[model samples]
Structure formats: C-alpha cells, structure tokens
Target: MGHVIVGVDEGPEAPTLIAVAAEMAQRHGAPLSAVTVGRDGAEQDGAPWLPDLLLRIREKHPQLQCAGFTLTGTPADEITEAASGARLLVIGSRGLSGISGIVRGSVSQAILEGTSSPVLVVPSRTTSDKHRASG
Candidate 1:
C-alpha cells in the first residue's frame, strides 16, 4: 500500500501538518512517513526534531506505522522524490500574503508543481490565533 508522506519543518505549523497527515493515514490504513530536508552543509532545526515528532505520533496512534527521515538537499526536490507514489503528501502553508508568498517562494507550491501525489496543505495559525490560543 502506498504510504502517506508528510513534509515536516521546525515551524509552528508542523504539528498541524503532522496531525492532519496522521489522521489521513489512519483513515486510509496507510503507513506514515515524516520527512525533513536540509540544504547540504546547512544545519536544519527540523532535523533534530524529526525523531521526537515520530515518537509522539507513534505514541498517540500506537497501531499506526510511522517512520521519519532527515535528508540533505533542496526541500522541494527532496520532498517530491520522497513522496513519489505516496498515497498523499501533506505540507504546511505559512499563510503569507500573495505578494509576500511570491517573494519568499513556497516549498508547498514547488512540491505541488513537481509531484504527482495529491497534497494537503494545512494553513498556519495567524498571529492573533496564536495569541487567542495561548490566552
């Protein structure tokens, strides 16, 4: 069975992306793979967090099969390659404004363009939402 693959980063939205992916995997009875990519020679904050994230997912869904991968390469390219033939690819959107998103470029957009797998993008919580959640 094709697995559900999730692109993970050490961003505030990572948990949301992971949770959505896990739920999809559970519903489909597919294994879950969490992947974080770093540029060659550059340190990635997400690299160190991948294992812990997988552990938490496993604990939360004890019957789910979960795996994590830390890779070095371009984020879009690596994620696309990893998601090849996957049942689904889950990613997070930072919810940047259109112009800002164009200026910054979006890994989710690039992956969407490059990969054949279906993608689910979880939107990031806005600043006010964060504050409200904390409040």
Candidate 2:
C-alpha cells in the first residue's frame, strides 16, 4: 500500500523493468522509488541524473509519487536496506540471478531471503538484442 522499490545498476538500463515497475506503481497508486546501486564513487556532478529520472516519472504520472536514490554500497546491501519499510520490492531476475538461482546467489534472492518485504523479480523476457533492435 505504501511504495514499490526497484533496484538497478548504473549502466545497462532495462526498459522492461522500468516500464513494468512504473505500471505496477501506477496501478497500485504507490510511489515508485528507483534505486540505482553504486560503489564508493557514485556521486557525480551533484547527482544530476537522479533529478532527471524523477522528472520523467513524475511527468508520466502526475498522480503518482516518485523519487530516485543513488546509493553508495553493494547492490544487495543498498537495496535490502532501502526495502526496510517498503510494501514491495521490484527487480530484474538477471540482475544478480541467472538460471541456477534457486541454488546459487543473487542480490534479488539474497534480499528476497533476507527481507520481510515481497520481491518481484521481473524476468528479462525481452533480451538486449531485442531492445536494441526496437530502439
């Protein structure tokens, strides 16, 4: 009922994940917090991109509340920490998990296992090639 958090990396932005997440957030009337994980040197030019992304999301859904957080930490740690009071957490399956996810480790799986919040692992149904082709 509160907000849905989407974890992402700096490069390789996934449109499917963002589109799906934005849709869900709009549907549920919940705030979409797009969290991009980074290491120590994350702050750049006073975090210009964060405000830009926020502007886009806010424009798309005037009724929806949205924000972005550029976190300086491991993906799992940053995302898990942010998911503390979230109603739901959304992330791409290929993020840190692949086919052998049930056994091996992934940031999504780790956060899923560790956090009490529900995590929605949106599969990379649309491949990179397809995205590039379409774009």
Candidate 3:
C-alpha cells in the first residue's frame, strides 16, 4: 500500500501536519513518512530532530508506522519527490496572507501544483486559537 507522506519543517505548524498525516496513515493502514528538506550542509543540526519528532508523535499515536527522511534540495521539489506514489500528501499552511495567500506559501503552492497525489494542507495552530477554544 502507498504510504501517507507529510512535509515536515522547523515551522510551528509541522506537528499539526504530522499528526494529520499519521492519522490518515492509520486510517488507511499505510506507513507514514515524514520528509524534511534543507540545503546541503546547511542544516545538519536539524537532521537529528526528525527522528525525535517522529518518536514524540508515536507516543501519542502508538500504532502509527512512521519513518523520517532528511533531504537536500528545494523544499517543494523534495517534498513532491518524497510523496511519489503516496496515497496522500500532508503539508502545513504557513499563514501567508494577501493575494499571494491564495496559494499559501511558495512551497505549499509548488507542492500542490506538482504532486500527483492528493494534498492536505493543515493550518498552523496559534496561541489565539488555543485561548479561543478554552474561553
């Protein structure tokens, strides 16, 4: 079965996207793959975080079959390549506004345009949202 792939980044919305992807993978009985893209040798420190992030996600979702990958390239290109043959692709919305916001950020827009698989864009969670929900 094709995996459910999620594009992961250092942004605040990454965990939300990962959770959605993991849930989708569990529902579909497919493995979940998290892909993080950065320039070569530019972010080696960030590579170790993917596994830890996956482990944390697994704690909440024990049944999720999850793996993480770090790649060097354009975020959109790497994400598109990573989701090849996937059942679905999950990404976090960067909350870009104005006319350009019609497509969100460049990476999200590029992935939407280039990926063959279905894409799910999860909105970034904000402190205001938490307060609104609790209030």
Query: Top model by lDDT, which number?
Result: 1
TM-score pick, better of 1 and 2? 1
**TM-score of predicted structure 1:** 0.87
Better of 1 and 2 by lDDT: 1
lDDT for each residue of candidate 3 in 27-120, tens digit (9 for 90 to 100): 8989999999888568565566678779988998898789988889889999999898999999976656677776545678889999999999
Query: Which residue segments of model 1 deviate by more than 4 Å?
Result: 43-46, 127-135
For each candidate in the order shown, give its overall lDDT on alpha carbons. 0.88, 0.73, 0.84
User: Residue 76 error for model 3, in Å?
Assistant: 0.4
* Pairs with backbone N, CA or C atoms under 3 Å apart (clashes), candidate 3: none
Reference-based TM-score of each model: 0.87, 0.73, 0.82
Sorted by TM-score, highest first, which candidate order results? 1, 3, 2
Candidate 1: worst 10 consecutive residues by lDDT? 122-131
Q: Residue pairs in steric clash, candidate 1?
A: none
Worst 10 residues of 2 by lDDT: 9-18
Residue 96 error, candidate 3, Å: 1.1
